[model samples]
Target: MFEQLGLIGCGLMGGSFALALKRAGLVKRVVGYSKSPSTTERARQMGVIDVEAPSALLAVSGADIVLLAVPVAATEATLKAIRHLVSKDMLIMDVGSTKRDVIDAGRRVLRDHVGSFVPCHPIAGKEVSGVENADVDLYVGKQVIVTPIDRTQPEQLQRAVDVWQKLQCNVVQMAPEAHDAAFAAVSHLPHLIAFALVNGIASQTRAEDFLTLAGPGFRDFTRIAASEPKMWRDILLANRQELLEQSQVFQRTLKAMEAMIEAGNADALEGFITQASQLRANWRMGPKKG
Candidate 1:
């Protein structure tokens, strides 16, 4: 069990993580900090954190494990804030959706202490955000992608895996670049499409009329469009190159289907639909448990 968990960013992701660790008896105390004083205060009042730190560095003052749940854009500044207190034995991890940029920030800010930092991306969260929406079951049975660089310490990596496993999370390791590329296609691109789809429809003349006719399929497909704008904005920009590459592939496939429909080629359309149906039917999410 960790003596103390220094949680930076007391929002949905960090609050939920602190709650999870507390529930699993993995950490004895949680010291949380947020950019907003009100957020840190609320997290403390809600029992998500045992103490509210005035600054990021103080949050990690005596902690053995630290979690940076801030946006990918703020990673470098956050690392710089707490770098002095970060030690070789400490296991520092981030829940940034994109790993390549986060790893780059760690290298630049943490320097020789970078080995203590383990880049992590937990494939879990809701469209809703904030400390009030934090749930202890957030990480339960979820797939957490840990992207470790060459400088990462083996002991620190094991500690990170152990912490997640204790929280009932399925731990998977990958190179930072590979993790970004894979998630761009699976996670990032989908959110981008969802955001764009909603905006595209809203910009049309009959936007209200179109929404009134939306069915369950449309609701489900556009669900991610409700995600926090600032968080998604950072994610989209951070993984833009990979996301754009995935978007191009998606556009080509869409154009192919459009061409078939325009030509009245039912056979080709059915073939394309069948391929996608099979692919989706074979996919499964990580097991979830209470």
Candidate 2:
């Protein structure tokens, strides 16, 4: 699909992209760069990329497609470092969880090149990090949300969609603001609650003992708490307004449940439980393989 592909930050996301493209024969060459020497070396040893660049600029140079797989906080800095080197023909895209900030940063640094940059968020990941955990099929059948601004070129948007389709992803397009707001409720707010639940429990007496008795439900609910803190922190801050609103809604729901339990309102509690159960059941019916 492309002559050469560049990946900036070869951690889980970038490394996985490289693996996917090569596995699908979508690219002839993949050049990757990461700040950590060990990560770059690991990616090289794993055959995730044909070449490893020493800097972000070198990695993106002469490439038809470039992916910024760094944290939301580092997106702007990475874009600035490679803005001048990025060829006009290159299709630049970011896999950051948040979109508005990254899209704005692209507009500022990339200027007219903004049309080439597509802000995308792949709603798929593992708790594990590094090149070792990278899988070629990581994005297969996953939903990839592409946020294109008014400045985005039609051809560039089509190219971005085509690339994700090649990776076997279900591609969907949305406005950057809408993407942020929706994800704030579904993704960011859930992560926050998981972290808070784990921390709150840890503060209680016999916390370690309580953990030993916890079941699959507790384990599943708090699994996201194990994700990289710095990355999640950046995502939360970047989408703070949407996240805060979601958090408030969550807080209200929690308070209502607590009040129902305290007042021994069986009917109200049952109604809440039924609604939650139905929502979860419906979610399970979405795009899952047997």
Candidate 3:
């Protein structure tokens, strides 16, 4: 879709995008920058990007499209660091999980140039990270959420959609608030529960023995607990209010289940299990990629 593309991060998601674009011949050249010099060198060695730039601004300079693939906390600072160097003709977009903060940050720095900026979130990732873990088809047929405010231009929105579509993503639109609320329920809450469960188990007696005897169900349920702690911490803090509400709802349900077990209410527990099983089954059967 563009002659030259700029990526500001070379981690899993960023590297994956670079690989996908190259495989699809969507861009003639891909330039990248990362805070860690070693990561930039590694990304180049992995052939994820055609070249590595010395600085974020230099990397994005003269590029037709610039993608901010850094963490949510770094979005505003990255935008400001490259504000003076970014051209008005360049289309800027961020793959941040939360949208409102990023959209507001763009408004502050982009101003009239905001027309070229789009807020987006790709709902695809792996527990592993870095260039080595990046896959060229990571986003193929995966749902990508594009959250645009009233100030977003139609052309810019379409450009963002086209880029993602070229990567073989299934595009979906949502308001920033709604996106945060929904993800809080599905994504954030599950991570929190997984973290809590693992920690809770570890704090008890015979923890090592318990883990040694754990089966596939336990391993699968707690796999997300292995994710980077810092990233999940930032995500939780960014979506605190929504996450808190979801936590309360989850706690109530857990309490109800506990009460049923305590009273030996077999029918009530059976009903709860049936309802939850059906919901999970529906999710598993739902249309989704990989």
Q: lDDT of each prediction vs. the true structure?
A: 0.94, 0.91, 0.87
**Tens digits of per-residue lDDT for model 1 on 62-118?**
999999999999999999999989998999999999999999899999999999999
Residue 174 error, candidate 3, Å: 0.7
TM-score of each: 0.97, 0.96, 0.95
Off by over 4 Å in 1: 287-290
Give the alpha carbon lDDT tens digit for every residue of 148-176 in model 2.
Answer: 99988889899999989988898989899
RMSD of each: 2.1, 1.9, 2.0
Where does candidate 3 stray beyond 4 Å? 285-290
Which candidate has the top score in TM-score? 1
For candidate 3, lDDT tens digit of each residue in 143-226?
A: 899998887888888988998989888888989999999989988999999999999989999899999999999989888999
Candidate 2 accuracy as lDDT: 0.91
Cα lDDT for residue 210, candidate 2: 93
Pick by TM-score: 1 or 3, better one: 1
True-structure Cα RMSD, model 2: 1.9
Candidate 3's TM-score reads: 0.95
Show the lowest summed lDDT stretch of 10 residues, model 1. 281-290
Q: Rank the candidates by TM-score, best first.
A: 1, 2, 3
Q: How far is candidate 1 from the true structure (C-alpha RMSD, Å)?
A: 2.1
